[model samples]
Target: AENNRRKKLLRSAQKSIMLWDPDGPARKPPRESAELLVSADAMFGLSDSFQRCTSPDFLLHTIGGTTRGAIERAYDWLIPIISRLPDTISRLPPSTSCFLLLRAYGADGERRAQLKELSTPLLHHVQDSLRGTLGEAES
Candidate 1:
């Protein structure tokens, strides 16, 4: 039952991160201080568990959601934890996490240089993992 509960929580976290529309009716930042405050708390709380998840799929999904949120200007809530990504990425073994991290790194050249540098090992791992499956094309 604990596993089921964790999965549910993970799903909820992903949904929250991915579905936060900055342009929504009342979701505008700075002015919407209350909601943004609550969201920031939740994001920090979930980030602790994000590091503990054993499944690569869940890690990829959570990181992807967070990256999407950041790109979409969910900075009010995600800014605090964004700095910790390099540490998180350092601990995780190279896997599907590379795919999403690469996407995040590509979004802003100046802002995400750390992600670009940190993704080096993951990029190599992904390259080796997919070497023969689709030929040498570095998608």
Candidate 2:
């Protein structure tokens, strides 16, 4: 049941990502795409869903060659939610966190500073967690 639910969420996220294209001829307008991306149902468990559904190497892969406008629009909608993630949720792998920060900060300079400030404690927590895990392994 849990696996089925996760698969459903993955499919839904993929559909949402496809529909979010801002430049495709049949795509909705940028504003609408942004709105859809931020909708609660659309965004539920977004980070975990994405991480489970796609390998990290391919996460955000589509945005790489896309126009900055499309990437920026997505970031605009995503940043607020990303900022509010609890420490438990925000405890993403280092690479994932870096990718998120790069996109979030690239979209809004002001947020870069705020996110940096907020991440300090989260980073320390993650480091401590890693240390504990390593210590247990060693013991």
Candidate 3:
């Protein structure tokens, strides 16, 4: 009975919270598209997982020598400046969004090459880890 009442209150609270927002209903992510993940509440936009390489170690190492140089230039030039503004603040502000967009336009060339290099190593480790985990889970 106590748990039931608490659950009811939680549900009501959630409903009330949702009502305060003007953006109709919240939509889920497409999960595979390259859309900007902006939110009025977000301090920073969400990140993307390139080629399913979401792991930090994988990203840090994968993001490359010459490509890293390019990205470093872009990162310095872009990424952080625009990632912070709330979508509704309104106006052309100096944000990393444009830099990132510009970088993204070129990101494919270097990123693809970097990804190609990282892919084999990443797949090998993922396959190995999944095998062990799946085996353990099955047991």
The candidate maximizing lDDT is 2
**Model 1: how far is 96 from its true place, Å?**
5.7
Q: Which residue pairs does candidate 2 place in steric collision?
A: none
Kindly report which residue stretches of model 2 are placed more than 4 angstroms away from their true locations once superposed. Answer: 1-78, 88-91, 98-108, 134-139
* Model 3: colliding residue pairs: 81-95, 81-96, 82-95, 82-96
Query: Over the stretch 1-139, how does candidate 3's per-residue lDDT look in tens digits?
Result: 9778655644544443322235576544342211222222233423333222334433234333225355465453123322332221122112222223344446576554443443343344434444665425533
Per-residue CA lDDT of model 1 for 12-118, tens digit only, reads 54445333555774333332443454456576875466554656644444345434443344332332343455444433333334544565566576446544554
Better of 2 and 3 by lDDT: 2
> Between the candidate structures 1 and 3, which one is better when assessed by lDDT?
1
Candidate 2 lDDT, tens digit per residue, 16-45?
554444665544335445445546545595
Please give me the total number of clashing residue pairs in predicted model 3. 4
TM-score of each: 0.34, 0.34, 0.22
Worst 10 contiguous positions by lDDT, candidate 1: 74-83
- lDDT over C-alpha atoms for residue 13 of model 3: 40
lDDT value for model 2: 0.49
